[model samples]
Target: MHIKKYFGRMLLLSFLTLPFIQGCAFFDNYARIWVASGQYGTDVKDLIAHWQDYNISYAGLSIENPSALLFDTKIDGRSITYEKWVPVTDENVLMTIVKWL
Candidate 1:
């Protein structure tokens, strides 16, 4: 009876605890590269993507949303956008997307 109770408690704790270990920001850095490989390809480790997730960068420019075909970007932390031509006119955004693709 006591063994059953302890085993139940242990099972519950293990389920609850594993996610917290996985969710830790410390693991995100190590995990992000692996996740990016599937989303952006194996070369993702060589690209300058945001540490928080997969927004890529080059030189000093970064895309706001790499998941979007038409999205904004930043240079030295300042936002950069175009009317209908981001990669057409913006060299940084162009290069960023090229690398991402």
Candidate 2:
């Protein structure tokens, strides 16, 4: 009887912690957009302003084809594929991206 009770308690604790553990993994797979940009860093500020003008709720922007100055992204399960251009004005685009986060 004591063994049975202990097992029951252990099972309950595991179930209670399951959601928390899953949540960590869930957020890990989510991708956050930092910013969007156009050629020569043009239209960035305007784009942001446009979103605001339209009352869009967005964390950041993602460019689809940096070469073409387009933005594309995909969200599936616990993975995100976001593409964006690196502003030419910024010397270190990678660092800038990290800073946006």
Give me the runs in candidate 1 sitting further than 4 Å from their true place: 24-101
User: What is the C-alpha RMSD, rounded to one decimal, of candidate 1?
Assistant: 12.9
Maximum-lDDT candidate: 1
Q: Tens-digit lDDT track for model 1 on 1-101? A: 99999999999999999888876665646645334456545443343343232322232234543544433334346555434332434556556566665
Model 1 worst lDDT window (10 residues): 51-60
lDDT, residue 41, candidate 2:
57
Model 2 per-residue lDDT tens digits across residues 1-101 = 99999999999999999999887567864776444556525345554433322212122454222233322212222422334423322324422443453
Counting only residues 3 or more apart in sequence or on different chains, how many pairs clash (N, Cα, C under 3 Å) in candidate 1? 0
Question: What clash pairs does model 2 have?
Answer: 63-71, 63-83, 63-84, 64-70, 64-71, 64-72
Task: Give TM per candidate.
Answer: 0.26, 0.30
Candidate 2 C-alpha RMSD relative to the actual structure: 14.0
